[model samples]
Target: MTALRSRVAETARVYRLHPPRVSLGRVVATPGALDVVRDHGVDLPGLLRRHASGDWGDVCAADAQANDLAADPACPARLLSAYDTAGGRLWVLTEADRSATTVLLPSEY
Candidate 1:
């Protein structure tokens, strides 16, 4: 995809847990793909620059806050999102410029 060789996706996912939670997504892009976005002049670091974007309320997390969700089968959706502090309140942006939908767990189990 780029002049640089991409790493094999031996594993991939998006995860967040301060309370042992799980989230999921289909377009599970690696941080490297995000680097590609950065190469295209997207201020990805800016995502970490601000706690939120516009009025969407996306919290910008620090390097110390990053985690993995590749092997998780929890939230099978299009996009993966979190509250940066609360996994019980995780969400997904189904569409651009759209509101986030909460990921609910079935209490049957």
Candidate 2:
């Protein structure tokens, strides 16, 4: 397997061991995110696993804490995580209603 795919599998395995903090509902990717995936080989599924598991990637402490609160299924706040990629920074965001989770470029936000 490619290194990225191997890492993504590992992440998926680990995440499977723990229940996700919140539901992703539906998952989608923005055009810019698809471009990053094609250009930089960013692991979208791995990042999504991390976000759902509450790893919160590269967010600041305050934002991380906010994400934690939003992680609760009862919280009507959005959840967001950031990760670095060869192309640039990528963001994973789940809406407040947990109806959808989107992989996107920070610029697209």
Candidate 3:
């Protein structure tokens, strides 16, 4: 398998073995996110996995200045952000129960 896919699989396996403190939410892609997937050929699920795993940095409390991944440190993130290797930024918002997550580009918000 490709390295990226392998990493994703490994991350998934780790999560399966020991889930995070907060349950992972269902991942959905917005229209603009789909467009980004088409344009940048990103593995959206992998990106989401990385974010869910807290592999991302640069946390911000507010949606503003979210050109990159940002999350509130105090609370379980209602939202998470990350950037792909190609420099594409993505934002993920989780439901109150953390049962659902929506992935979108920064500009889409």
Candidate 4:
């Protein structure tokens, strides 16, 4: 699968058991923060709501300043998928990785 597809698959597999706590409602944050949502299990639409609900400038400005990986094009898309059965919180995805035997969390991102 493609990188984004891989991420989506991993997200789907991990989130079924655990749910997320908070969903950021800001649009201005880095792609990484939004990717964190993919890292959890949330979808694009949900993310859009979160973004539209908050400050897109605040959320995105820092990434532009630091040029963080969150600004990457794929990060945002990778996080949203059909597999987000749970809310797909980041912490939960991390914990699931520890519990499993796979390196679903790509080190590159």
Candidate 5:
């Protein structure tokens, strides 16, 4: 966890985006999400760096009007929905202030 957090901080520095407090979605602990993470060798920190640097794999939408970017019941604001190299759909949601980020599968959303 410490390593992951450090990587995220490094990423933020490189991208010049606000350093985000990162956490895995609750669903990530489920078997399904874990399987995908394992199978795809999901480099969370690397993915986050890519996302912050605007290397979005496939952007679904960006909503600046929403107040809460991480917990919106509906569409998440500043959403970066993309498929990983393994063809798994992943969603990265960042807070309006860019102070936090949550990574989850689309189904978890």
Candidate 6:
């Protein structure tokens, strides 16, 4: 457990050193997402931090590649990240224009 915690801490440090590639603009959460977070004690900010830092969480390879491309200022595409939580799955999306970021359950989307 200590080793696992150490690895997690090291990973977090790496992400912290890397700045967000795009602006989150306005952050909003759906009611369902809020309920899920509340029910499961989700760490919303930590998830968002990972998304912003390009961690991409549990996304598929193709989606991860798309997110990588989207990170490039010249090739802006929408950014999507999926994370599995105790409640279920949460998704975070940042628009291509960087106008907003939304947090929602897949059912809400």
Instruction: Using lDDT, give the best candidate's number.
Output: 6
lDDT of each: 0.27, 0.84, 0.60, 0.33, 0.53, 0.87
Better of 2 and 6 by lDDT: 6
Q: For candidate 6, lDDT tens digit of each residue in 1-109?
A: 5774565466678778888767888999999999999998887887788898899988999999999999898999899999877788999999999989999988887
lDDT of 4 by residue, 1-109 (tens): 7786676565445444344322433224335545655665556443333222221212235433332232233343112211222333221111111221111112323
Query: Could you report the Cα RMSD, in angstroms, for every candidate shown?
Result: 15.1, 3.1, 5.9, 16.1, 8.5, 2.3
For candidate 1, what is the lDDT? 0.27
Task: Assess candidate 4 and give its lDDT.
Answer: 0.33
- lDDT (tens digit, per residue) of candidate 2 on 1-109: 9785566577668777876787888999999899999888776776787888887777999999999888876666999999876688899999999999999999898
TM-score of 6: 0.87
Q: Residue pairs in steric clash, candidate 2?
A: none
Q: Give the best candidate by TM-score.
A: 6
Residue 23 miss distance in model 2 (angstroms): 0.9
Write down the TM-score of every candidate. 0.20, 0.81, 0.58, 0.23, 0.49, 0.87
Candidates in descending TM-score order:
6, 2, 3, 5, 4, 1
Question: Model 3, poorest ten-residue lDDT window?
Answer: 64-73
Question: Can you tell me which runs of candidate 3 are displaced by over 4 Å?
Answer: 1-21, 57-77, 84-87
Candidate 6 least-lDDT 10 residues: 1-10
Per-residue lDDT of candidate 5, residues 1-109 (tens digit): 5775566456546665534333223312345555677887776666765655454545534532222243343543444535354537676666544455666677877
Angstrom error at residue 102, model 1: 18
